[model samples]
Target chain A: MKRLTGFWAFTLLLVLLPIVFPDNYYVTVVGGTALMNAILAVGLNLLMGYAGQISLGHAAFFGIGAYASAILTTRYGWNPWPAMSAGLALTGVLAFLVARPILRLKGHYLAMATLGLGIIVHIILVQTEGLTGGPDGLSDIPGLAIFGWAVDSDLRWYIVMAVTLLLVLWLALNIIASRSGRALRALHGSEIAAEMMGIDTTATKTGVFVIAALSASLAGSLFAHQQSFISPDSFSFFFSIELVTMVVLGGMASTFGAIFGAVVLTFLPELLVVFEDYEVMIFGAILMLMMIFLPQGLFVSGQQLLRRLLARRATGTAKEGSHGAA
Target chain B: MNIRKTLSALAMGTLLGLGALHQALAAEPIKIGSFLAVTGPASFLGDPELKTLQMYVDEINGKGGVDGRQIELVHYDTGGSPKKAVNFVKRLIQKDKVDVIVGGSTSGSTLAVMPLVAKARIPFISLAGSVKIVVPPQKWTFKMPHTDAMAAAKIFGDMKKRGITKVALISGSGGFGKSGRAQSLKLAPQYGIEIVADESYGKKDTDMTAQLAKIRDSGAQAILNFGFGTGPAIVTKNVRQLGIDLPLYQSHGVASKKFIELAGDAAEGVRLPAAALLVADQLPDSDPQKPVLLAYKNKFEAKYGPVSTFGGHAYDGLFIALEAIDRANSTDKEKVRDEIEKTKGFIGTGGIYNMSPQDHLGLDLSAFKMLEIRNGDWTIVE
Candidate 1:
């Protein structure tokens, strides 16, 4: 009941913030991009934070989803929503198939394999110009529709993205509290221990991997529709790095942490306009400082402070009660 | 607790202060936003553009700026990624409230920003040369460099004039290379020539001997290699190593001296069509592009040391944009866009640009001069 109230409160705030925005530009530029980053980060958190699997090439799946929907809708004259569904299904199936051999590798080996996968995807996108529009990228992607109403405005798109994000978050939180979630945590702690406990480690890992890919695909689809265009360069190696940064900067194991991290990282560069030349340098420095000072993450730091304050309040209340009794 | 309060206060204060500064800055300057690939693989293109833009801005400001308002260039590094490019352009339009935007070093980055600029009704001038930059024609978008198709047509036409009937082709499998190949093939028959041999290699592949050997064994009189950057250099080096001494016709992309440096002695006699900036010494004094070329060459070499045709495009792009702003007499984006579209015989470093609504690409084949590397120096081949 408490979690449900909190979730409603959060959703209400997100939905109402755009109403107070001074201009449509603000909602579209800052709010829209934040929502997009949130989708990517939350999806990635499932793999890195929950499944204990790191994929540096998750953007490849995102790119595949974008290109799939784009090509299908634009070339074959299919509806955008159905094409998006097909894209998500295709990415999920692909992830499920590749997860077995890929998830077997651990640590740096896994990182390199994922990196190679992203590079190969990028190369193929660039090489196959006839279908994918080559380096110039595909333009004129159709907007999202429900029933008969088309979502064209930034506010409308933000609502779509935020609702999608909330749905995914709800699903993810549920999974985290479920039996499979416990198995994933065990596998993350120790594969040998998880196996000894009779947990199907491989199946769990593959299941979570497909889920993460689906989330990325869905986000990519949303991104494509919002931007009204798609390009291979949109899903480059750097985007993968940014997504990873969001997962880490947000407390790795916390859902709220993902949202906080996505918002900060998305808005930080825009707010620091005067220091534009040193933007990347400052971003790197902040990441380093956070890693050193608050190793757990910004979310964990905030949580620790909140806990300490609450503890002090309880202690003061107990002291007052004891004094009155005496 | 006091320290925590103080830190939070400091953070809030800094944020407010920065926001206030941006607001103040916004009111005073004619904000021009630029999206450049400033810190990635394509930084090779963006770094020069940034330097050129800085130089132009400084020069304009020294002359009291346009209409007595200082020019402020707000640049964002897209890192050569289209998604970053789109995000940067959106921020530029919505957040920075820029009057005009310019500089997309790569074709992918340029095309990504086209729709946003159009939707926002802001003027955009692209420095990249992909034909698609102007295709389907967004009202606000314009390209400074000649397209790949035009470059191919000029080169192939010249080859036909020189009686080079059977030409061997070598290209990379990348977008730029593939586009060049397509244009060359499409335009080949028009020039009454045939592709005697065609071979391709991956962009990152270091070995080109097998591809070059195939081209060498085809018994072609000349080889037309359509590639840029390191790929062309490798092809040149490999072709020399294979002892194939036929006339080597390179695409305009390899006009840079870096190609000669990379190809070493093997770069001699490589022919390509380039702007007058590459071989400024050979251009006649009466030529209309001479003064513009001289000024750009002098300023660019002083600022960046040795100007290439790429930088020449940057110089021309900046000059054309400034000229349009001056002609418009106001910072109104729509007016400036219209002024730019109606540009006729606007003397620039590359050539006289005559832009039209149907033609967003200002320059054409006539803007380029055929040049070859002779004794490690760019010289007119004719």
Candidate 2:
């Protein structure tokens, strides 16, 4: 009941936001981008926060998804829907193959392995002049349409992205509450212990990794279609790091935390536009301060403060009632 | 209750602020939208461009504005991403409601936003150097820099005149480098020159000795580098260290004082096609671009620091847009776009711009002056 209420409240907020900012371009364009980042961050939180795995090169999956859709639709003349599905499948397979070998390493080693994978993908995208159009990239990719009704306008894109993000969050929440979710939690707690308890550790890790990569793939496909262009520069290693930052800054284990972190990071630059040349410097300082003040992530610390305040209020009420009885 | 009061107060304040900003913007006569890569991987190119735009707009406004109306410049930094460029362009057209847009710092970014300008029906003057930006010649899009094809043509034309039948090619793995390489290869036979050797290095590469050695032994008469930034400078130093005696040529991408400083004494005698602004002091008194180039160079260098061709590209785009806006005498986008198309014999830092229905760039092959590094300064090869 509580989870459903939270989901509905979020949905209501999403639907109401556009009404408040009617005809606003920032809401539709920048806000739409925020929603995409939220989608990527939500799935990544599952793997990093729950499955206890790190992927420093997650942008590789994003690039693969974007490139697959772009190439299949533009070159092979496939429909956008099937092209997106094909991209998802290809990204899933790539993640499965890479995750099997790369997931064995723990901590920083795994980070470096994923980083290597990302760099290789970026290099291929740049070097392969015939297929990916080299660095200039492929443009004029058709927009996503259903029965000839195209999702073209910024408002339409925002709605589509918001709905997709909701579906993803709902799925993530359900997974976090399911039986396998417990197993994943156990795996996160202690991988060797979970294996001794008969949980399929490798399979669980790879499953979550593929899921996270698929999420990134979906976001990338949408990005390609929205911009109507795909480039090697968009899915570089820096993007992967930014994704991890979103996940951590939001509070890794919390789904809403991921979304909140994504929203902040996405809108932070725009909000800091008034800072002009001092923008980068101030952005860095704020991020540093956030890390210092709330090392457990912004959402986790904020929730803690709320709980503390509620507890204090309850205790004060109890004392007042006892004094009246006396 | 206290927190609620604070939140409501903040909301009210924001609303009032927004209302005031809206009124202020409505009162402005003309709004010019600018999107540049002011702080990212391409900031080295964008920082100076932003400075030039800021200084120029302020100067125009100070001189009683453009045609008795204040010029309101709305600039946004793209951070060198096509995705961001797309978003900014949309905001510029839809939200800011600017009459004209002058922006796009890189080939990829410019190409990314090219389709949008036509859709919005706004006059767009691109600062990017890709030939494709203006090759098909979208109705509304114009470019500032000399195209990659023109650079290739100029280098090949010079090489052909010098009887250099065979040349070695080295390029970086970037959009600019790849486009230049393609143009060179495509125009080689047409210019009666043969590509005897071809090599490439990554954009972040620090040395090109191995590539230089291969080009040295390729039996080529001269060498050409289709790259920019540190990569070309590294190749230049490597060519000198390897004792390759053939004449060296580079693309306009390396036509900056920074390239000379990076390449050290090895940059001496290396020729490339560049805007006349590079050799502005050396330009003849009667040269059409001399005065405009001198004014821009003096103002830019005096305020900021050393002036580069990248900034010169921004200056050309701004002036062109301003000229069209003034001539149109209205903020109507279509009218301004038509006025820009009709521009003829307009002196700019790049060259004399002459716009046509089929040609948006409005500059000829003569726009590029082949310059060589003489005493660590740009000198006309002629």
Candidate 3:
């Protein structure tokens, strides 16, 4: 019940943000981008933090979703909603097909395999000029519409993205609190032990992987519709690395932490834009400082500090009461 | 309690900072908003472009600004992502509320923000190269660089004059390369030139010997390389090492001296269509572009170390906008858009910009000077 209230508060904050900013660029434009990255980070956290599988090619799934929707709607003249759904389905299937062999790999081996997949996908997107429009990428993609109303403006996208992010967080929280979520935690703790304990490690791992890929696909579809344009450059090995950085920086296992991290990473560069040539330098320095100060991740350390403080206060009062009775 | 305070304080600080950043200037100057890839994969193009914009803004402002209103430039580094470019465009339009927008360093970035400017009805002067940015006439967008088709036409026209009927085509896997290759292939037959061999290399590929070896054996009379960045230099070096004596024709992308330095001894006699600013030292004073090119070259190199034709694109964008501002005699966006479209015989860094209702880029074939490298420098071919 408390968690539900917190979720509502987060949603309420998101809902009221635009009202406070009132048609400002930060709320409408940068806020939309932050929400999209948050969705991707939250999905990635499930696999990396919960299932304990590393994927260096999340951007490939993102690219798949983007390109799939872009091609389907623009080329075949399908409606935006159906095209996005088709993209999501195709991404889920692709994830399943690759997860079995890939999940068997462990540690750096898995990371390398995923990285290779990302590169191969990016290369294919670049080489397939007739379909992907070569490196320039496809344009003139139509925006998403609900019923007869078009979601064209940035302010509208901000509202849509905020609602979607909160919903994804709620789903993640429920999954984490469920029986399967316990199984995921057990496997994350010790996969061999989980297998010995009659847990279907392969099935659970593959399920989470597909779920993560689906989330990424949905985010990508929304991204394609929102921007109405995409290119191979947007989904590169570097972007995958960025996704991983967001997850780790925000506290990989924490859902809200993922959101926090995404918000920070997305806004940091936008904030640094005023710095001109010093932007990259300052951004790198700030990130380095954050990592050094909070080695366990930003949100994780903050929560740990709060817990320690509360525990110390509780124990102090209890000791005082015993001493007074004595 | 302490952490919560800190978090709130940080948030407050950021909001305050942004507020201060967006505070309107006291003098009521005309704002020129720009977004470029100042840091990223395309920084090679954007860095010089940024330098040019900054230099010109300062110079114009020093002269009491255009129309007696100090030019206040609100520029952002897009980092070469269309997404980032779009965000910056919104910030510039909504928050800064600039009078006109003057930058887009890549074709993709420009295209991404095209709908925004069109909807906002703001006069946008694009520095990126892409025919789609202006085609179908988006009502308020203008470009400075020659379109890919124009550059290809220039190259093929030269090929026709030299009686070269068969040529080998090599391009990179980039937007510029892909567009250039398509234009050349589409127009080759009309120029009576046949592309006997076609090859492509990745952007990161350091070697092109394999591709050149195939071209050497393809019975081609010449090689036409269509690409920007380090790929062209690699092709040039590969051709020289293979001892292929056929004439090598390069796209306008390699007009900068960086290409010559990268290709070293192999750069000599490589012909490419380039803006007159590149060979400004060699052009006669009678040339329309000579004086403007020399002035920009002198001022820009003095301040920014070195100059390139890519930076000249930004120069053209600003001055053309300035010309419109001067003609309109007001900061109204619609008037500026109309006046910019009325621009003709305006000689700036890129070329003589002649904007029309049908054509956004006003340059003709004369804008590009056929230049060949000699003694590690750009020299006019004639």
Candidate 4:
């Protein structure tokens, strides 16, 4: 119930942000992009944080989803909604096909395999010029429409993206609180022990992997529709690394942490744009500082700080509440 | 602490003076917003482009500003991502309320922001090279750079004059290289040149000897490399390494002296079509572009090291916008855009820009000078 309230508050904050500042570019445009990234991050966190399987090629699924939408709507003249669904389905199947073998490899070997997948997918996007428009990438992808209303403006896109992000967040919370969620935690704790405990570790790992890929795929479709432009550069090995970074930086095992990390990583660069050439350098420095200061991840540390303050202010009343929640 | 104190004092004095001037003049500075890949893979283009804008904006403001309004350069380092470009361009339009946009370091970025700039009805001057930025020209977007297609035409035209019909085509898979290759392949037949050998290298490939060997055996009369960055330089070196005696042609993507430096002795006799700025020192005094080229060359090299044609594009873009604003006598978006489209016979860095309703980028093949490397320096060839 406490976690539900926190989730509700987060959802409310996202909903009210653009309404409060409709004209603010950061809130509308950057906020929309951040929400899309949050969905990707939260999904990846499910696999990496919960299932204990790392993916270095999460962006490949994203690329598949984006390229699927871009090619279908633009080339075949398919409707945006169906095209996005096609993208999601393609990514899901591809993830399922590759998950069993790739996830079996542990540590750096798994990383290398996934990295190769990302590089191969990127190469395909570039090499298949006739289909994907090569390095310059496809353009003129149609925006999504609900009935008669078009999701054209940044504000509209922001609203759509926020709703999707909150939906994904809600799903993630429920999954984490479910019985299978306990199985995932058990798998993360010890895969061998999880198998001994009669948990289908392989099936659970594959399921989470596919789910993460689906989330990234969905984000990709949203991006393709919203921006109406995507190049191979957007989905690269670097981006997959960034997704992993978001997961780790936000407290890998925590869903809210992933959201916080994604928003911060997205907003940080946009905010630092005013600094010009020093922006990249300052971004690196700030990330280094954050990781050093709060090794437990930004969101987890922030929540702990808040709870500490609450405990201090209303120690007797909140003591039982905190005990029951954890 | 002492230096910090002095710096803060200087900042304070400038703020006070600006405040006083704001009340006295009451003329709002015209915001010339820019988004460049100043610190990314395309930094070679964006770094120089940004430096040029900053130096010239400061220079223009130093001269009592344009139209009695200080030129305020609102710049952002896009890092060459179209997604980021979209965000920064929005900030430029919504928050900065920029009068005009004067930068986009890559074609993809320019294209991504074109719809936004069009919707906002703000005149945008792109420094990227790709004809698509202007082809089927958007209402309020203008670009300053010879298209890859024009470069292909220039090379093929040069090949025709030399009676070379069969040519080998090698290119990189990057945006510039891919576009240049496409243009060459598309335009080769028009120039009565047959691409006997077609090959390409990846962006990260350091060697091109294998591709060159195939081209050599393909009975090609000459080789034309459509690429930029270190790839072309390596190709130039590789051709020499393999001792292939065929005439080698490079694209304008490698017009800078850095290519010659990277390719070393192998760059000799290599030819490419480039803006007049590369051979500014050798241009006859009577050339209309000579004075402008030399002035930008001297000014830029004096502050920032060696000058690249990429910087020249930004120079033309900024001056064209500023001149149009002055010609219109207002910073009004529609008027400035109209004036920009009306730009004629303006001799700036990237050749003489003459924008029209149909031609957003008003340069032709004549603007691209065919130049060869001599003694590791750029020298005009006919």
lDDT of 2 by residue, A1-326 (tens): 76567678989999999999977877888899999999999999999988989888989988998998899889998898899999999999989998899999999999999999999999999989899999889987888996777897888999989999999999888888887788889999999999999999999999999999999999989888887877898999999999999989988788888898999899898788788888889999999999899887888777776766776788875542222100
Segments of candidate 4 deviating more than 4 angstroms: A1-3, A315-326, B1-25
The fraction of correct interface contacts reproduced by each prediction comes to: 0.66, 0.80, 0.66, 0.57
| Candidate 4 docking class | medium
Worst 10 residues of 1 chain A by lDDT: A317-326
lDDT accuracy of residue B231 in candidate 2: 95
The true-versus-predicted C-alpha distance at residue B373 of model 1, in Å, is 1.2
Q: What is the overall TM-score of model 3 with all chains considered together?
A: 0.94
The lDDT values for all models are 0.83, 0.88, 0.88, 0.89
**What DockQ values do the models have?**
0.53, 0.71, 0.64, 0.56
Q: What is the lDDT of residue A237 in candidate 4?
A: 84
| After superposition, candidate 1 runs with Cα above 4 Å error | A4-6, A22-27, A317-326, B1-29
| lDDT at A248, model 2 | 92
Candidate 4 chain A: worst-modelled 10 consecutive residues by lDDT:
A317-326
Candidate 1 structure quality by residue, lDDT tens digits, A225-279: 7777777778888788888888889788777788778888888776665587798
Task: Score chain B of candidate 4 by TM-score.
Answer: 0.92
TM-score of chain A of each: 0.93, 0.95, 0.94, 0.95
Docking class of 2: medium
Please give, for every candidate in the order listed, the TM-score of chain B alone compared with the true chain B. Answer: 0.90, 0.92, 0.91, 0.92
Best by lDDT: 4
Task: Write the residue-wise lDDT of candidate 3 on B77-110 in tens digits.
Answer: 8889887888889898988899999999998898
